[model samples]
Target: MSRNKQAKRPKLANEGFTGRLRFFVGRALLNIRQNAFVNIVTIGTITLAILIISLFMLVFVNLEGVANDWSKRVQVTAYFEQELAPEELATLKSRVLAIPGTDRVTYVSKEEAFKRFRERLKGQELLLEGITTDVLPSSVEISLKSASRNSDAVAVYVDRLKKVPGVTEVQHGEEWVRRYTTFMNFLRLAGLLLGSFLVLAVIFIVSNTIKLTIYSRKEELEILSLVGATRFFIKAPFLIEGILQGASGAGLALIILTGCYYAFLHNAGNFLSFNPAAAGLAFLPPVYSVGLFVSGVLLGFIGSATSLKRFVSV
Candidate 1:
């Protein structure tokens, strides 16, 4: 009998953990069902907040992609002097290649340049009818390495290229690059500020929703407190409820985001002329999707905890 009682003790201890979890989860669902209208309002608010954040993330990610593409495309064109010898041109190529950030240098012959120009104006050959290959300039197109494509790095290369012998002109669109960089920086800052505001708004909405839930169960909580229930026992269900609310809201938001993504993809051709989608815009990556879901759960838990701190006196 003693051995049997000891064995039963371990079994009961194991059951206690599972039993507590079930109790908390069940109570959370019960509360949600009992306060369906309020829960719906809270969840809807969270959905809106998360959806706005997701849209911003989508835009930010794609714009960042476009910026990177533009950065990679930055090139420095060095037009050579009209009567340069082969040896001097070869020496010039070697010198340009020796620069630290130089990725690769392509020498475009005058004839090749003329051919490219003709191809560009294929339908309107009349524009080039009077043009000769000698009228075009033989230039070296310098593509910078990925690590050296920024404004400062490109400026260093531009200064170096200007002093190179046999080069009559060096062109790098410094003004345009600077303006683009500034625009992207402003966009990033705006997204961050807007996201922060939306998160705070979500917290406030959740807190108020939980506060009402607490009020509805005020008498029950007071009774439990008087009956000597531990603080953890009293608060566990509310915390769980908050988590559910947040997770459900995030799930809804993700569904909406997915729908929007597919819709955008389906109708992408219509907006191709005006939008970045023309250049193969993609949805947020998997890691960011997971992050959004985690953020939602954390936000809900935080909001619930804040409300509980005010209402749960014990």
Candidate 2:
């Protein structure tokens, strides 16, 4: 008897695994086949949602990148007074560069500034022919150590810059910078709100899809319940079905995203000449792709779990 029981243990374990596998696979296929229309709709909705999410994430990241670059390169143009001497302007440039957060101060001589102005007015050579170095002011162009969109930090620098000698004007459009940051902040917030709405929408669509599939098998579920089957035993298959649906949908979305990115790179290669890999405009990374896929799968399972809870409760 002892030998027989030990032998039966291995058989039982194998049977259990095989049964579970069959149960899950059977339900997954049944769900897919039975609710073809609704399932397709759900997948479509999920794909659209993920695509929007991918695009917004790309835009937001690049916007933040460009903002940082602009901030770091935010030039504080310090124009000198008309009567300011060249020696005094040179001394002022040296002092300004010595300050903390000051990366470099380029002194734009009056002659160099006039030449640039003439170059810019290439077509209207007659208009700029009489222009001399005296017409352009000597100035120090300031570059900061780090790019930042922080208003307080920018305000502090603005105050300090105004105090420098030979500084006729320290001009930077703080309001303009503030507005741009605010706009980006608004976009970030709007994306969050939209993402939440889309996620909730996908959950509902998936739940209804799973619910319809479960309803078609109401007889089987009822019979199991009648035969003393536990809720876990009855719901396990449906849960697995939902997971399959979610995973498939995520995989499809990833494929679409990859294709779109590749197409963009291929077609827009000329515009992307400045950056070989187009560092500024890039697709979502592998980590994010995996995360999104997992999220979709989990959402499917959770939606199924929630929808099944009511039936089990009864």
Candidate 3:
């Protein structure tokens, strides 16, 4: 190359921060081009790993949405043995609202309760023929906060409600809530374990793959070391290369994930749910997508650093 053409190869050992950054980016790109096959393999491996983890996240995200939807049904009803005056009812509503984890307080008069019962037993109107408003209890229906819908929190909330004056009894679906909470906890634990394992596996794979590139350029690194190059100068380009590979892998994985998600929806819409039109299939949320991208970048950074520790000590 002519001197006026300015090759970056001769300027590796010394540069300012900005110059160093430019050099690192150029070198990373150069390395990727020169070792195109190895870099492609590394990026492909990263993409596969990211895709698997993202698929798991998509399922888990949908499950969490279902859980939140069901949790909305977790209501606690405080029944009164005798009917209360209008003022008494107002006072009770205020007190319940003041309690922690109370999302809403709905007062159900005896007549309203009777009407609801009748609606539920629509065809069995005969069952309610003799029943009057006095036959049913008037109650304050307490809808819980999202965070307090779990069994333990609901139990504590019920205990507090029972202590309120005029409350004869408090009832929530204890057994159902207990079972649901157990299942949710188990799901979270399993996701955590599996997610952790996948992340570590990808990092390991990337590290080993990067090691191959390092081995191929062993002599070049040695020459840079003898020429008084800083360790960071030698490591920066490889680190940047890893970052690029990681980011590209994540982007490609997301593209593939989107394609698969649409394909699933297209086919499943014909037969999947009882109401296929409202099957509610969803992709990863924006927050989860951000997490995936960050995970990819992290995978690359840690992997490249690990591989460079023993091999590139300029």
TM-score, per-candidate, Cα-based: 0.76, 0.66, 0.90
Error of 2 at 236 (Å): 3.3
Best of the candidates, TM-score: 3
TM-score ranking of the models: 3, 1, 2
Candidate number of the best lDDT: 3
Candidate 3 residue runs with Cα over 4 Å from true position: 1-15, 274-277
By lDDT, is 2 or 3 better?
Answer: 3
> Any idea what lDDT model 3 has?
0.86
For model 3, residues 238-302, the per-residue Cα lDDT tens digits are 88988998899888899999898888777775665554226576789889888888888877777
RMSD of 1: 5.4
- Candidate 3 TM-score over all chains jointly: 0.90
For candidate 2, lDDT tens digit of each residue in 1-314? 45554244344421577877886678668867886876676666566666666666666666666767666645567887764577876677678876666777887878878888888988888987655679888777777766444565666776788888667688767786677667667867887897788667756666676676566667877888998888877788778867776788778878887897777767776765565255556677778888888977886788678878767753
Determine which window of 10 residues in candidate 3 has minimal summed lDDT: 269-278
Clash count per candidate:
0, 1, 0
Off by over 4 Å in 2: 1-10, 15-45, 55-74, 80-107, 123-137, 143-147, 150-153, 163-168, 261-281
